[model samples]
Target chain A: EAEVAQSPRYKITEKSQAVAFWCDPISGHATLYWYRQILGQGPELLVQFQDESVVDDSQLPKDRFSAERLKGVDSTLKIQPAELGDSAMYLCASRIVAQSNEQFFGPGTRLTVL
Target chain B: SQQGEEDPQALSIQEGENATMNCSYKTSINNLQWYRQNSGRGLVHLILIRSNEREKHSGRLRVTLDTSKKSSSLLITASRAADTASYFCATDPRGGSYIPTFGRGTSLIVHP
Candidate 1:
């Protein structure tokens, strides 16, 4: 029953400020994903990481967002100069290499920008 | 942009009743998964139906996938107040990548 771990479960900040969220996947998981969920909508993929390398980041806004998993274990997502539209629930998920396609999710960080 | 769309955005049912949610996708998939998310919480995996499989069940939840029609349905029988949550359908397409597209979700409120 190991679960993904996320920090700063709730964050409130003003526009133009910098914010960062962290996630720690399951012990043996090799694939980690970052997603953003707007109100009344499903989660949208922002970036994906395989071990320490980024696999896909097409949906991520490069000008303001960046994610890294330097050690291939824990990951951090940062948004510089946050915007009002950035207020959403940031979720992290992880999947094992040889297991089923089910991805384990963390509690998520709820970001509110004023 | 998501590949799946769910019908009946919201539903309210009394306790001990059954709840059904339908989902439709636009592309060929390797698997279809159902997930539940309570208010202000993370998502919990419910069940998954592979492309080659037509029907699957877990506990009181039953999931059926029609690959030819590109549709899937999730049924929750004898539900309780705790079953009140938002349900989402995610699809992993048949290809090299592993990312799954998620639909907006169906909100179900089981009145006690």
Candidate 2:
């Protein structure tokens, strides 16, 4: 079974520093999602992309967070001047078009800010 | 905003026992899905129940959806220690977009 791929499974950085995470969705998946999960809470959507265009990003903190899926296959999420509250698991998921609503998730990148 | 809220923030059970978790949502949905996440890991899709369907089963997992009540339940039968994890319920609202909103998960610990 093809799976979503994520890099930097663990990241530790100081506050006010910049950090970035990468994700590669399964081949042929058109919809990609970025989510942030706080400890003990379910994941929240930060952004959604259809191909190379963003579909929704209302919940994303635009001032500090930005995500892009340049080629529509892989994506990158960056945070400038990370804050302590920004520490959480950054998850990437992808869904197959015309298929069931089930999403394939990658082992998330855990970001810890000090 | 999160649309689903799961009941019983935490649960503990012995091996071979059945565990059940419930989720209630505030809006109409196209489908409700169950996911499991182990400590320090990503979530794994468990099962999905559609609005039109009442029940679904996969392996040792069973899910039921009550559209009228906007609620769903996930049951794991004969659960083992490996089943210890946080279980979350995600809903795909019946709107134009496919964005899924998740609820605070129920932490389940199946003691061996």
Candidate 3:
């Protein structure tokens, strides 16, 4: 089965530094989502993309976080001047637009800020 | 929080035993989905029970949705060691938006 792909499975950085994570959704999937999962907590939506356009980013911290799916395929999420509280797992998910139901997730990038 | 709550945050059972977890939400939902996640990995889709449906089953997994009560339950019959994982219930609320709110999840340990 095709799976969502994420890079930098593990990342450790100092607070105030910039960090970015990448994700590649399954072929033909048009909807991509970014989520943050803190320790011992469920995943929380950060942003969602439909093709190359953003759908919902109500939960995203716009001041420090930004995500883009410019090509309507792969996506990138960035956090500038990361803070200690930003340490968490960043997960990417994708689903087909036409069918638009269940989401498939990537292994996720585990971020640790010191 | 729109995320909802799941009961019995943690459960342990022997192999071949059954495991059941219940989820309760605060809002009207279009559908409820169950997902499983092994430690340090991504979540895998399990089953989805629509609000219009009362019960659904796939293999050993059985899910029931009570929209009137705004609660859902997932039952795993004759579980195995491999069944050990964190089970989460995600709700897609009514309206056009399809973003799902997820609860903390129930951790299950099926010992062999």
Candidate 4:
């Protein structure tokens, strides 16, 4: 069904290290989102992008996290000096340009920070 | 967080049984959606009910929304072992075109 694509499905790292995840939204989708899903909890939005411009990042920990969609298609999320609490699934989602609510999600990256 | 909150955090059912989960929100919305995830995978969109619509159905899935009560429900009929997954309800933000907010999901276990 032309699903969203993500890389590095699983990652394990030590605390204070850095890691990055990548996502490629469905072709022609213009809106992208990054979410953090903790154990037994719903996904929490971290950042959003409209094409190449960031639309919302209020929930993002800008101090250590950064996300960019340089070409308005593929996007990357980076976390520096990861903390134990940063161990969670990082999900990337996208929606069609004309739609604002329905989103397509990618197989998220399960990060384990020891 | 403006997230929908679901009830009966978890449910256990046998194959061929019906499973129902409810979600409640606190603000006006343009749409509400239900998503499902397996043990460890990305969320899969199930059904979406718009503010102006009362109910919608897809396959064995049925979704109902009540704007007056700010609540919704998802019913999966004739469940299967593969139907075991976490279901989440998401609501469109009230004012502007903000990102959709999600509620803690209902974990459904279908016993074969």
Candidate 5:
């Protein structure tokens, strides 16, 4: 079974610093998603990519957060001047074109901003 | 805005017992999916029920969908300690966007 891969399973950083997380989706997957999950809450969509093109990003905080899937295979999510409230699990998911609603998820990167 | 909302935010039960969690959504959905997440980890897709389907089962997991009531339920039979995790329900709206909306989730603790 092919799986989505994520790097730096855990990250700790200062509040004002910058941080980045990477994700590589399952091969042949055309759609990718990035979500932020706060403790005790469901995951919230931050960005969605379709073949290297952004499909939705209304929920993303553009002022401080940014995400890109240049090759439509792997993606990167960055947060500059991170805030304490930004500490949470950053999840990456991918969906093949045929699978209408099912998504494959990576292990996720747990970000902790002090 | 959240599309799904789970009931009984938390549940605790012993091994061998059955656990049930309910979810309600606001809009017409094409399909509903259930996912599980361990502490500090990513989510894993468990089951999916289409709007036209009423019930589906896989191993120890069972899911039922009620499109008329706009609600769904997940049941885990003969639960074990390893089943302890947070379960969430996700809905894909009927439109073409295909973006999924998730509920807050139900935390289940299966004690051995």
Candidate 6:
């Protein structure tokens, strides 16, 4: 089965540095989402995209965090001047827009800011 | 705080036994969903029971929803060692098209 793809399964960085994560959703999927998961917690939605337009991003920190799906197929999430609290698992999910139901997730990029 | 709160922070059961976990939410919901996560990896969507449905089953997994009480339960029967994982309940509140809100989840350990 085709799966959502995420790069750099693990990342380690120092505080105040910048970090970027990439995700490639399943082919033909039109909706994509970015989520952050703290330890011992469920994933929290940071941003969501429908095609190339941002659908919902109320929870995203506009100050230091930004996400974009320029081509509407793949996406990138960037955190500028990361903080210790930014260390967490960043997960990517995608679903078909037409069908618009169940979502599939990628393995996720685990970030550690020391 | 999360809207959905799952019962039994952790549960240990033997193979062939049934694993039951319940979830309660604070507000009205459009649908309740169950997900599974192994270790620290991403979650896998298991089943989604809409508000109108009372019960749903897929294979050995059975889910019951009580909208009046704002509670739901997930039952995995004749489980296997591979069934061990963290289970979570998520709720999509009424009058929303965004993503669902999730609880902390139940950590189930199915020993062989």
Which predicted model would earn the best DockQ? 2
Model 5, span B22-107: residue lDDT tens? 99998999999999999988899999999999999999999999999999999999999999999999998887677788999999
Candidate 6's TM-score on the B chain:
0.96
Q: DockQ-based ranking, best first?
A: 2, 4, 1, 5, 3, 6
TM-score of 6: 0.95
Per-candidate TM-scores read 0.98, 0.97, 0.96, 0.97, 0.97, 0.95
Expressed as tens digits, the lDDT of each residue in B1-112 for candidate 6 is 5889999889999999999999999888878889999998989999999989999999999999999999999999999999999999988778766566789999999999
| lDDT (tens digit, per residue) of candidate 3 on B1-112 | 5466888899999999999999999888888899999999999999988888999999999999998889999999999999999999998878766778899999999999
Model 1 has fnat of 0.70
TM-score of chain B of each: 0.97, 0.97, 0.96, 0.96, 0.98, 0.96
- What are the per-residue Cα lDDT tens digits for candidate 4 across A58-112? 9999989999999999999999989999999999999986246589999999999
Regions of candidate 6 where Cα sits further than 4 Å from its true position: none
Q: What's the CA error at residue B60 for candidate 5, in Å?
A: 0.9
What would the per-residue lDDT of candidate 3 be over residues A19-82, giving only the tens digit for each residue? 9999999999999999999987889999989999999999999999999999999999999989
lDDT of 2 by residue, A53-108 (tens): 99999999999999999998999999998999999999999998523579889999
lDDT of 2 by residue, B1-112 (tens): 7888998899999999999999999988888999999998999999988888999999999999999889999999999999999999999888767678999999999999
Best candidate (score: lDDT): 1
Error of 1 at A43 (Å): 0.2
* Candidate 2 wrongly placed segments (more than 4 Å): none
Q: Give lDDT: candidate 1, residue B49.
A: 88
> Which model is ahead, 2 or 4, in terms of lDDT?
2
Taken over the whole model, the C-alpha lDDT of each candidate is 0.94, 0.93, 0.92, 0.92, 0.93, 0.91
Tens digits of lDDT, candidate 1, A6-112: 99999999999999999999998999999999989999999989999998899999999999999999999999999999999999999885236798899999999
- lDDT by residue (B1-112, candidate 4, tens digit) is 7479988799999999999999999988888999999988999999888899999999999999999999999999999999999999998866776668999999999999
Evaluate residue A35 in candidate 6 and report its C-alpha lDDT on the 0 to 100 scale: 91
Measured with C-alpha atoms, the lDDT of residue B16 in candidate 1 is 100
Candidate 5, residues A19-56, lDDT tens digits: the string is 99999999999999999999999999899899899988
